[model samples]
Structure formats: C-alpha cells, structure tokens
Target chain A: MPRATSRATLFEVAAQADVSVSTVSKVLNGRAGVSDETRARIEALLQDHRYQQRSGKRQAAPLLDVLCYEVDSPFGSEVLASIEQSARLQRIGMVLSGATEQATPYAHWVDDVLRRQPVGVVLIACKLSADDRQRLRSRNIPLVMVDPAGTPAPDVPSIGSADWNGGYQATRHLIDLGHTRIGIITGPADMMASTARLSGYRAALDSAGLTGEPELVRPGRFHHADGLEQGRALLSLPDPPTAIFASSDLYALGVYEAARTLGLSIPADLSVVGYDDLSIARWAGPPLTTVHVPLVAMAEQAVHLVMRLNDEPEMAFSRIDIDTTLVVRGSTAARNISK
Target chain B: MPRATSRATLFEVAAQADVSVSTVSKVLNGRAGVSDETRARIEALLQDHRYQQRSGKRQAAPLLDVLCYEVDSPFGSEVLASIEQSARLQRIGMVLSGATEQATPYAHWVDDVLRRQPVGVVLIACKLSADDRQRLRSRNIPLVMVDPAGTPAPDVPSIGSADWNGGYQATRHLIDLGHTRIGIITGPADMMASTARLSGYRAALDSAGLTGEPELVRPGRFHHADGLEQGRALLSLPDPPTAIFASSDLYALGVYEAARTLGLSIPADLSVVGYDDLSIARWAGPPLTTVHVPLVAMAEQAVHLVMRLNDEPEMAFSRIDIDTTLVVRGSTAARNISK
Candidate 1:
C-alpha cells in the first residue's frame, strides 16, 4: 500500500470516519466488505480533508487472484481459461486458489492471498465466510464473484446467469415434446442456483398439469460422477422418467453414461437436457441439448468489473445477470416409449 | 538473490568459468541450460573455495509453479487439480500459468514467475523457449516437464506416460476386433507424443502383417473440435475405417459427435478408442475404451521431483515414463462390414 499525500493522509480520514486506519484505507481504495454507510462516511471525510492524490509504494506488479470452490468443476475450466486470457492480455499476474471442502473454511488461503497482496480477486462458485470477507474488505482489496454457487452476501457484487429461467425452459421443452414423466438432476441442494432450478422445474411441471414426482428429483454435486450415480438411480426406478433434465452439462453427460450402461439410446429411449453449454457439451454423443450460460462473457465482464472497482472505489456495486437461452441440439426427442 | 559466503560470490564463479554470472549461478543452483563442462568447472571452483554452505537468499516459501500450453484441455484440469492437492498437503503455494498461443513466447510470463520466485516449475505439454530456459536456470529455479509436448531437452527432466505403447495397444485391440482399416487421429504433428503414437499405430499394423495407409491418418490438436472435423472427414471417405483411435479422450468425444452426425452408433457401426482415460472418458457414451494415462500419479510425481530438486541441487536429473494400459469398456466391436 502506498502512503497518502501530505494534504490528507488516510489517518485523517480514519479519524474522521471513527474507523481504523485500515478501514479508512479500504474505503479509499474502494475495496469490498465495507458497509455503504461506512463508505459514505469515509467519502465525506476524504472530501472534507481535501483529499489529494494519496499514492505511495503501490505498483502495477500486483497479481490478480482467482478463488474457486471447486477448481475441478466442469464449468470452472472454461471460465478460468477466459479469465486467464484476459489477465494475460493486460499482462497481469494471476493466481488461482480453490477452497478445500473440509469442514473449515480454506485453511490459511486468505492469509496467503493477503501475503500476495493481489490487485483484486474473482470468486467462482464460492461463498466467503464473514471473517475472510471482513479481512479482504479491511485490506482494501477489490473482489467480484462469477456464477456464485449460492446467493451472494448482501454487499458482494456478482455476475451470474438466469439459471431459474433456464431450468424452466428446459423442463418446458421436455413437456412440450409430450413428456410427462420427467426426471431432474440438480447441483448440491444448498446452492441457490440448484434450488432455483428445482423451483423452475416444479413450476414447469405445475403449469403443464403434471405433478413432479419427488422420487424423480435427485440432488448431488455439480460433477459427472454424481450425475452418473443419480441418473442411474433415476433410470432404475420402477416408473422411470422418459426425459431427464440435468442441472449442469456435466450432470447430463453422466446421464448419458447411465443411459449407455443400460443399453438405451439417447433421444430414442431417453431424452436428456443439460445446463451450462460448456464446449464439451456440443461434442457429447448426440450433441447435448443444453441451456447456454455465457461463461466467457461472464468471466470477461467480472474481470472488467473488478478492475473498475479497483480504480473507482466510489462507484456503487450491484449484481449483473446475463440471460440464458435453451440450445436445442440432438439430445432431445418426442416420447416414444409407452408408460 | 542472497549474497554468498565469504570465500566467493556468484561473480567469482562466473569469472572462473569464463561464463556470464547467470550461467555460473545456474551451475551452482543445479538449474538446467548449463553445459556439462561449464557445470563441472563451476562445481570444481566451489569445492576448491571450500564452499561452506554457500547459500543465497532462497527461502522455504517454496511456491510451486505450473505452466500448461492449453489450459482448457480435458487432461489439463485433472492434472492441475491433482497438483493443487499435492501442493496443499505440503503447505506450499502453487501458481498455474497458461502459455497463450497468440505468438509471443508467454508474454511477460517469466517476469511474473521471477517476481514470485517460485521454488520450482512444472511444465505440462509446454516446452519453454531457449530464452526462457536460460532465464529460469540463471535465476536458480528447478524445472520439470509433465507429458512434454515434444522431445524435452537433454538436461531437463520429464515425467510422461508411455504414449507409444498405449497407441500400439489401442491399435492392436482394434485389429483384434477384426478391423483391418482403422483410422487414427493424432495431436499436432510436431509434438513428440503425437509422432510416437502414430509410430506405434504403424508398428501395430506391421506386426499384424497389414498395410498402413497414410490417408487413414489425421494429424491435428488434442482438442474436441479438431476431433469432430477430422473424424467427420475420415468417416465421409469412400472406404471409411471400421474403427477410429483418437489420441485424447477429448478428441474421442468429438468423434462421438461425428458418429452422431453421420447416424452411426458407437461399437455397433463405427467402433472408437480414446486415450488419456480422463474422468469424462468413462462418462463418454459407451464408456470410451482408452489408453489410461496416469494423470494424477504423473502430476504427483512431478511435484515430488521438483521439491527434491529444490532441496538437493546435486541430485542427478533423469526422465521417468509411466506405463499406459488399454482399458477396454464398450467402445470397440468386431467389424461387420467387408473391407
């Protein structure tokens, strides 16, 4: 961190805001975590003190940090690839860290980030705890989230896709094709996206005058193995669903495996739909029909947002969600099997 | 770098070797890019000076660096995830950097690596340029290659799977299935792995007393899109091969798309074989029969080697190759059509 100018150092702002010097610095730097009220107070103090260019010791050498819940997630690779490309274009250093799934929050992850003193951080499918959130804010570091795994905190800005609508459309597509017995596979039950998607599935079923069977809905991680296991369970049920809606492309791919294991042909015997049209989706057997999540666009925009947040601390932050569309490929077909 | 012992600094070693200060540093630090004669001379000087723990500013911070040419590759994700796990266990920091193919040799990548001063670097399917090799060695950093894209330099150590044998076995399997005309998709023509696999394919045909046609081979990247295009082309030929061997699991998935587009069923119409046996491979339609590349084990071993290199500068450097096996599932079948 650079020292402030002689006219009004950060100390004065801290004194005026009745906050710690670090809090005042964070406010000055436009880092996330500070409450709007506190930020406003700090802003007023800076103006009152005739804030000048408060710069010292800061360099452009700081790395850009990326925090992901599961770096191995199917959707993670594309998003990180895009973020990395953008970082390289600007010659910014980047460090990617994943939160361990252990009971405790990332063991020493925040401390490592603090030590690196990254210019800003981008989180994907990750939610921060109160302590780490506070630490990042007080440190005056900018943070942004991409497709946050759950509902973001009150103040954390994020970029996500219209997953609920995507789910609704995918379910409705299957319904429109004369499919009443539809099974749905979702992400971890706690994830807001998963719940919203589940709700959308229910809504579609209700609108179609079909009561979705509780036995048909399976919840698991956003991974292929989970998809395969859940899909097999669904397919093995007494009254198996004719169509399956997987919450993620990876999940849907697992459904493909389940269908294959049973010697069932896609579309002919079982219609399947996936979300997050990751590049691999189009290459899946029968070219997976999926809901397209603008992965690259979201990543690019998140980087842009964090950069802006780094430069203009005074700018207000909010959530931005891109609309998702159903991409009908070769994976869906009209119901051919009798109930 | 920290200053050396009272007997002599890196400058004295450079003067004695009639080489640049960086080369002498490389020799003493046990980094690659230094010649045998020069390294021997530098070692003799250190011994003559009675080098009493001629330590420099190296610290145990011990952050591991990982570089890959294609960050979005199917195999890249699993390898990195494993590397991250190993790194966390050792309480070491890991930084992953992707070499952008847009021309400039990893624009400013070396500068960023130097700034972090990583204890060691692991390159996956990426070969450093001469300039980068020199820079890393001069900085006294250890380097290891994982599944090197091409034949690694003599001095640099590497850990890779027996791709040639894997390719040979996959071809032999197809031949055993009574398929005389087997098409093959390889990675970039320049990559050593690509050529090696292609060689193995030819060897299999020779061993079977069958003629191998160059027209049946397609050389491209280890990517799905390339697989789709090449697979489509091969299948569209007048006398399409009864079975296809794709070099990467990702490439085989693309072939699945082509098969779908051409209305051909896996194992039933056009048998397929894949390599790398990535997690997605099992979920691929028909549970792709692939050459299992021990991705996780290779990454773990690479990290272990780099750590050892970091600790013992005088330890001999050598290449290690793990065995690859054909994991048969449901993707191959006996040829039913006349050749």
Candidate 2:
C-alpha cells in the first residue's frame, strides 16, 4: 500500500505514465480534453505513487463535501440543513450530493470530489468502497461519517445517536403507560443502529419481567410503506398490540395511516411512539411522542471531527454517540381497559 | 452604477484606493491581513470602477451558490435536493446556505460568494438587498430566484409554479364536489405567489357565482401554526364553511391538528385541500388532497437558467411558471349536509 508520507511529484508521475506534464495536470485539475482511458491510467498511477497535491495551490473557496444517502428524506434533509448551517457559520462552503440507491455515491462522484478538493468529506447514512477510501486517502482528504448505513470501517471515525438508549427509552415510555402488549417496527436488519435499537427493546421488555412475543416484532426497512404493511399485519393479529414503538418517524406516520385506515385513533385506540423528533413529529395529527435524535449536535460534531481530522490526520479513530432523549407528546396514552 | 461592459484592472482599483495591488488582491481573494476599513475602501473603489476579475485566473472548482429561506422547511429542502441533483449532473458543485429569519442572507454571505466566484447564484424563496444585487452585478455573476419572496426584482430571472392556476384548480375541485360555502387560508400577504393564489381563489368563487364571504378569508405565513390558528378561527364560526383551501401543505397539516383538537375528522366532518403536495401530504392521516407544485422541474429550470445566464450574460430578464395540477386524495369530499 502507498504511504501518505511518500508522494510522487507531478513530473515524476507524468514520466511514469508516459504522458506530457500538461496531460497529467489536466487530470489533476479535472479539466476536460483528457481521454477517459488515459485519465484512468493516470489516476491509478497517482494512487500507486500516493501523489498528494499541494494544498496551498488550491484557489477554490474552502468547502465541506457532504454526501447523503437520500437527500429528500425527512431525516436526511434535516441532518443536511443542520450541517449546512454549521458549515455556513464556520465560513465553509458545503457541496452536497445524493448517493445512489445502493447507499453509495455514483461512479464519477469520487472523480468530482477529487476535482473539488474540499477540505473534508462527510457521509450521512452512506458508505464508501475500499478503493474510494484509498483514493481519498491518497489525496490526503479527511472523511467522517454520520450514522453510517452499514458496519463502519475501523479506521473511519463516525458520529451517531445512542440508538440503544433511545430505543429503550421509547419502549419504556410505552410500557409505563400500561402497555404490556406492545409491538415494534424495526429498521433494516443489517444496520448496527437498527439491531442495537431492537436489542434495547428486548432488554427493556426483559427487565420489566414481561415475556416478549416474537410475533409482535415485525421487520421493516425504515420506510413508510414498511410501516403501513407491517402495522396492518400487526393490527390484524388475534391479540393486537395496544401500543407500538415505531423505530423511525416516517414509520410512525405510516402507522398513523394504518390506524386511520383501520378506523382507529391515535392514543385512544392505538398509542404510538416514534424515533427521530423531526418537524413531522409535531405536525402529525395528534403530535407524536418520539425520541429526539440530536441531529444538530451530531452534524456539528461531524463537521468538527472532519475539520479536526484534516488538521490532525494522525488522530486515532474514535466513535462518538451523542445522547438521545424521549420527548413526550400527545400520541402516547395509558391503556384503555374497556377496549 | 457599475456597467457590465465596463471593466477596471486590479492596479487601477489599488491606485484609486491608495493601497498596494497586493493589499487589493488580498481583499479580492478574501485572504486575511487586510484591515476592515481598508478592505471596505478597496471594495468601494472596485465596485465604483466596475472591476470584473478575469475568469481565467480562477482555479476553483465550478460551484452554484444556493441561498434558501428556512432550509429545513419541507418545501425548501425538496427544492434544494432537486437543485443539488441537477448541479451534480452538470458536474457543478452546490454551495448551500440558509437565509436569516428576515429572508435575507447573513452580512458576510455576499462577501463569501464573491470569494467563491461561483458560476452563478440561485435564491430560493429569499430576497437580496439592492446593494447585494449590485455587488453580484458588479462581479458579473448571474442571479436567479425560485418562488422568490416579496416582489421579485424586475431585472432578475425567476422560476415559479403556477400558483394562481393551482389555487383556482384546488378551489374548483371542491366546488365540483358540490361544495358552495368554501373558506380559504392564504400565505403571507407580501409574497406575490400568495397574492396570486388568493386572486385565483377569488376568481374561482366569482366564476362559480357563489358569494365570497369576507369572514371566510384568513391569513398565514405558510407555516403550520398559521394553519392551525386560522383554521380554528374559521371553524369556530357559528356557520362555518364545510370546506377549506389551505394555500400551502404545511398549513394543511396545521389545519389537520386544529380539526383533531376540535373533534372534527377529515373528509367526514370537514373537507380540506392543500397546496404544494410535498411528501408530508402523502404521510398525512387521511392523505392530503393538494395542488402539486413541480418542484423538481422548477429546480432544474433554476439551475439551467442560471448557467445559461452565466454563458449569455446579456440575456433578457424572464420568468417561467411551470404548470400546477390538483391531486385529489382522501382529504377532500362532498360537504356533509347534516353537520
């Protein structure tokens, strides 16, 4: 593997690639007129040699690159807005891009990022391939992740909310309301955050001396559709849950729709709790009782960490999980025995 | 006033400001070490002499500046996400910033823009001061607005949805459903879009030969609180209208909350129609019947127009309003006669 301390000069790289210095410069600056094959070869050679461009020569404004999995999702947008505000406060330009459906950026995204030469990159609910990581590393660009989609690489620092505690608190709130038969809609199984939340839910039930029912735990992908489908199924069971802990705010809305479709009203007929106290939580018909993820704090931490890494590249890899708190609202209520 | 055709050299600006060329260069590049007083004086001279920096000297990555009001608002985020996508497709970076509460950018936002030297600037539901406009103009940076707040400057191109037609279509939908007594919740009085929507609502009532009641008209700032406040006020009347047209989707959610608080159910007790069919509309309990604003298309147009203006700086000021359509969902129904 190429080392950061050893970097090849532009002239040396051009000589090794058997290309003119201007041709190498064109690829380096993301200018047009370079053939794709030659560009690829030069990029591979640069990576092999670990060519690091001099930062002082970059004339662009200071920028922070942000790559989000779903830029329009309620959670994604809120996180993005927070980061944009923080970046603005620090006088850093934010360059935002949406990841592809696979929770990764498009093919040419890395090329573009190399061209922009942002001070650092922040990935929200997305992952980067090893090759992409090496490319960014070769350029000496720092990267930080917020709530990474999958298992975060050991070397990359990440920021996330305390999903286990949030899940435990949400479930505990429902349990305190005399809801023994409570259902839960879980996020994607592969995500550590989702699994942690689910484990917390089970722990809460076990600690309460109640036997958790496997049938009551339904799987979902943190989508509204999943909420609607799973919610309807849960409600259709012989012994339906009196309350539900939806793992996401979006899922809670779907549950609301499900209840509405089944002629049930929130809190009165079927109580619900949600995660992520996004603005939608307040706008829900009855207002949602939810776990508030400190998105703003997390965003600030992400930006701060990325900048810190840029300044101190040798800093050890660390994970910071901000605290999560449950916000009580109108959606949750005590069980109605008569029903 | 600085003319776009006339230009001044850095040396001339420095001479006029009684400073060395390097000091003037420091201010131009937004580098530190220049005193505020001196920087101000140099900026005045640069603007006075119509100093247009040579574009070729800029080595920064291509960027499109986006200034949005209420960056986290449902409407704003969606528009931002769209523009980000379009900019990425064009290999242009998007530098996003949230405007202050006053619908104007912070004091240093313009200075930052000048330093970035973006291809162009796009303002979303935000306005620029005359001085700010002049600064951008002196730099020969093109500006475009999307659903601009207040009155759009005559010289700036803007992209907007057909608010008037949308309002007409929404009100007409309720009318066609056999509702004669209809109430309307309008957006901020100052925004041209809001006024145009109100006019369309009035035109629809007039064409239907129904007497529009002054008591039925209420005001809002396109916020959920306004929706709830105005909705409750209208619904509390001794003889309240059976149907309501909320000018924005957020207002519709507030109206939903208000109705829930008043023991009223949507479509069954009262019919509600909302504008700007954002994702929240679908997530609403009964789902919202709303006017669909072509936000993606509008965003694309904003990017395309800004880029076009950059290339053709002398293009005439123009406004494009994409068509709006009424999407009938579960929120609206025939007026209940027994209520």
The best candidate by lDDT is 2
Query: lDDT of each prediction vs. the true structure?
Result: 0.79, 0.88
Candidate 2: deviation at residue A27, Å?
5.5
Put down candidate 2 lDDT per residue, B12-130, tens digits, no spaces. 88778888989987777666788989987987887777676544344446889999998889998899989998998888888999998878998789888988889999999999988
**For candidate 1, lDDT tens digit of each residue in A1-339?**
332346346777787678998887565444457887997677666655545443225543457788876676667878888888787777666677777673123676766666666778888888787656766665557788886665568688888888789989999999999999999998776677788889999999999999988999998888788888999999999889999999999998889888988888899999999999987787787888999998878888888888887787546888888889999999999999564
After the best TM-score superposition of candidate 2, give how far the Cα of residue A35 lies from its true spot, in angstroms: 5.9
lDDT string, candidate 1, B1-339, tens digits: 232455356667778778897776555444458776877677766555544333246553347778877676677777887888788777666777787563124765776676567878889888787656655665557889887765568788899889789889999999999999999998877677788899899999999998888889998778788889999999999989999999888888889889988988889899899998887787787788999988878988999998887777557887888899999988898998643
**Two-chain DockQ for model 2:** 0.68
TM-scores of the candidates in the order shown: 0.80, 0.94
| Residue A42's lDDT in candidate 2 | 88
Off by over 4 Å in 2: A1-60, B1-15, B20-60
